[model samples]
Target: MIRDIDVVVIGGGQAGLAAGYHLRRRGLDFVVLDAQASPGGAWQQAWDSLNLFSPAAYSSLPGRVMPGQPGETYPDARHVVDYLTDYEQRYDLPVVRPVRVEAVHPDGDRLRVGTDTGIWRARAVISATGTWWRPFLPAVPGRTAFGGAQLHTVGYRRPADLAGQKVVVVGGGNSGAQIAADLVHATDLTWVTQRPTRFLADSVDGRALFDHATARRRALDEGSADTGGVASLGDIVVVPPVREARDAGLLKAQPMFRRLTATGVEWADGTRAEADTIIWCTGFRPALSHLAPLGLRGPRGHIPTAGTQALEEPRLHLLGYGDWTGPASATLIGVGRPARDAATAIVELLSLP
Candidate 1:
């Protein structure tokens, strides 16, 4: 027999935790199912040295304040995980751990979710698995045949992991930059990027740099003469690439690789850079395999959610899915409203005759 509930949240990450918090506060009957043994999802897997660019000021989740010194710098990945674990304990959130949900299907005014543990039936489901489910690995011919050590940015922890090895860090995003900078001290590093990203220093009027997104939003609402376009995080936060490398004589910037061979990376312009290891920092994708039949997914695999690109489905919602818009819709600070609203919607759905 399948266990039944009002709602079954399909993840237990930050987004999922936020969702659960609101659900509990609203006195709703729900269960959170997660594959991981604990909360804090991808955060727990982050590199030890990794710290959020956003300071503790704007990083708190709903209700619980992130414990730290005021005007202090951003917290590391471990701090984030610890905070989330504390949130779970404080709320007594009904989260069932180590349960991998395999599939979900609509079933007669309800939904049936299949997991390794058991079957679960719910009137509504919040699929808050997040956008980092699948790692984006570029399709390069002869990639699999390469005999060198290759890793995705998700698995990369620190420079010591690649000490003394000639490493080729792929992609131009924030993660790629940080990894390259960290490894420079311990290895022969080549930062192979598709294109040089336009960078900005992380500060404003000599104040502790806040998210440029916050500034842009205020500019629009105030109707000031200058409603500047979406500003990049590069404008406010100090990116590792700019702070450490490019400034120091540590890393060599190279063009993106056109092809891959057993020996090293081959650039589009017929240039070759030999590397002992290749780290793909190409980013991630949304995992919506279970959402296949929803038919709400856009041109890309992303779903067009209502609150935060939440779906039209009454109780279904998504937080932090990407768009060309300004900053991440799914940031820890931004997720509260959507989670609250989603909980409200779920409660209303349950209360109906």
Candidate 2:
């Protein structure tokens, strides 16, 4: 039998749980469907050394505050995983795991969420599946011909995995910088960036970044001047470990190489660097393959969204992908506002008082 729910949240991560929290408050019948066998979502997959840019308190969801880790300023990935596992239990959110959604299809007024287990017909579907599964690698020439070990952020676990080998780290985002820093002392490292790396001020953390995003969102909503938001501050935030690497002059990034060689990489100026491994800290694209049945994805592979809802399909809300859905919506702290907004909108749509 097809289970019927008022809403079906397509993930059980921070964004999905946040949505569940608000929906419960609104007295809605919903279930968060997760593909993973357990809780913590993508945090369960993060590298061991990864930590949030913000302190624990600043990185929180809707109802509860993430407890501060006494000795640590920024919590590591395992800490995050623990908090998430606890949060799931604390909220008592209805989350069904190991149910991989195969597709979302239109079934009259309700949407049919086809999964490996069975079908769930939901009035509104919130796609909160964050971008961990879909690691992106740029199409540099001869990349396929490279003879060394190559991996993306999703494939990375620990620096010791590549111990004693010459490693090249690609991408200049926080992941790139953080991973590079983690590997610096562990391996022979070459950091490459498409352009000059942009590092935020030493003091800029998650709290400050969220504040900037909120301000920018507010200004845009008011149709006011452009505030630039968090993007204006630069890309990489110098987390503690990253700061240590920078202070030691180990975080320097060379110009992006032109292409991969059989053994390593070649630069535009004819310089070549031989490396045994290339770790692409390149980010992720949204995991929206289940929604493809709806034919809602645009040319850019993103569903056209207006304030979190698919412009073409109002019954669908794409949450926590990025700023396109909501300002800083992909973040733990930034996701609350958009989650609340989506829930509030759903309440109004169902004619709830």
Structural similarity to truth (TM-score) of each candidate: 0.87, 0.98
Per-residue CA lDDT of model 1 for 1-353, tens digit only, reads 59988889888888788889998998878999888987788898997677776666578779988887444376778888988899888999988999998887777888788889899889888887776778889888779877798999888987777889988888776677777777888898888887765455545311223244556555665786543433443422355444776677665567777788888878768888788999998988887777776666676677665554345566565654542221344567766666787788778778899
Give lDDT tens digits, candidate 2, residues 257-349. 999999999998999999999999888999999999999989668999889989998889999998889999999999999999999989887
Candidate 1 has a TM-score of 0.87
16 Cα displacement, candidate 2 (Å): 0.5
> In candidate 1, where is summed lDDT lowest over 10 consecutive residues?
202-211
Q: Give the distance in Å from residue 261's predicted Cα in candidate 1 to where it truly belongs.
A: 1.9
Clashing pairs in 1: 202-236, 305-309, 305-310, 306-309, 306-310, 320-330
Candidate 2: count of backbone clashes, pairs at least 3 residues apart or interchain: 0
> Which runs of model 2 end up more than 4 angstroms from their true locations?
none
Give stretches of model 1 more than 4 Å off.
69-72, 204-242, 293-295, 308-312, 323-327
RMSDs, each prediction? 3.6, 1.3
Per-model lDDT: 0.74, 0.92
